[model samples]
Target: MSTPQPQTHQQAAPAPNWQSAPGTSYTSPIPVTRTHLGHALTSEWTKIKSVRSTMWTLGVFLLLVVGIGLLVAAQTNDNDYADVPYTIPAFFGLILGQICLITLGVLVVSSEYGTGMIRTTFTASPQRHRVLTAKLLIFFVVAFVVSALAIGFVGLVTSGMHGGASDNEWGGTVLKGALYVSLLGVLALAVGSMLRHSAGAITAMLGLVLVPAILPAFLMMSESLRTVGDKMMDYNAPNALAKIFEIDSENGGGTSQLVLLIGVTAAAIAGAYVLLERRDV
Candidate 1:
């Protein structure tokens, strides 16, 4: 048996430096803040800007789009435009420039996977979906803004060269083109997330964009496949951009193309979420 000892009282917990939410108490002295989408956006923006890939890709994109656009504008006279929009010049440059944006989209997610940084990212965010959402949002915004500026600049130059009386539609057309390119990059990101390999995702995206335009020829050879071939030819990315600029007027506007791409991107993103939540880093 042991000798009895005097009882002691426990001290109360210290208050946090900041006030807690109503009816909730946090005992730790260190201040705590709730996480939200803004935090994730900031993190993603920081990561995207800090990398060299973003710089190189965006730089090349601007150079090709702007340079090619100006060159085309300089060579063409107002009569060459006829019923077409002045923004038509920008379309040629974007045909090649979009590759850079697509590549950047693939690098955004796949690079993290390649370097084992996704594990750290998931550990930090905890909610895998939030990180994915943040990446999509961030990439879309950057891609859209940069694309708009470059396209807008080219449009302005083209309009200045051929300042016809009826060239008032440039603003709306420029925004629409930018939207298409940005969504394309987001689709690339979705593909990157699903594949988790940069080259494969990029190649797959290239095929997705290019094959439809080319395969239509072979597809058209079959009378039964002709309808499908016609649709693909009409709705392919190049034609979509061309349609937006009024360069492909006989085929209707780009509204169908945008709607189709949005649907596809939504489906790809849904699949990416499923894979992200189920698969280990």
Candidate 2:
């Protein structure tokens, strides 16, 4: 009987490492992967598409650009110059569309901070430059697509008025306009990153782009200052960048203006990056 009892006993198999001990809890770290910019871009794309503001903003831009262009084209008399670029009237809505694009781009970064999601993003990405570059990539893609849509729509709508559907130029002027608008979008992201406040950044951007534009309208007294302001408006600041879109202009010939505007854009971006790198998010 003792021999039989000894023979009946057998060893049990080991429990899996995944299994918890009796009366103990089991926890696992989230399977996080270290991602490069492409992943970050994909993530950002998801976030952008998930938000309603993006869709609404683009929708409004499309409507205003195409709608105003059609209206202007239809209302035109024969006196309009034949030298005018096929999509010239589209410029009427461009300034407005760009303003919206800049605001939206700024919010893409600033709003994340405002909502405390930036911390989560940084934590997930861990690489600062990667994060910034990813954001830049995502923003550029969106801007390019939106710009193309706006220009294409305006060209198509205005084409009908300019000599049927085939007359659209789609040349240097349209390309320059798209580039200028896209750069503004990038500039917005940079500004927002540095400022970290929407109202302040938007206000500053408006001042940078708008105040100089309206200076003549508001300050009509000083002749010397007026002369200077006229020069400033004509070809010495960001407004000169607009000249690139002017079909009538010979090629944004104001070298000083282009140089100064470019320098400012570079400085703004660099300043923003420095601040972002140094400051606490």
All candidates' lDDT scores? 0.91, 0.71
Q: What stretches of model 1 exceed 4 Å from their correct place?
A: 1-26
Best of the candidates, TM-score: 1
Candidate 2, which ten residues in sequence have the lowest lDDT sum? 247-256
In model 2, the number of clashes is 0
True-structure RMSD, every candidate: 6.6, 7.2
Q: Taking the tens digit of each residue's C-alpha lDDT, what string does model 1 give over 43-113?
A: 99999999999999999999988999999989988788667777777898999999999999999999999
- In candidate 1, list every pair of residues with a backbone clash: none
lDDT of 1 at 239: 91
Candidate 2 lDDT over 1-281, as tens digits, reads 45554457567888768866899985558775666678888888888888887888778777776777677778875346354555666676776777777887788888888999999998987776677777777887888777777776776666655564343345655666666667677778888888898888888777777777777654556765877666656752345544654543644533445555556667877887778778887
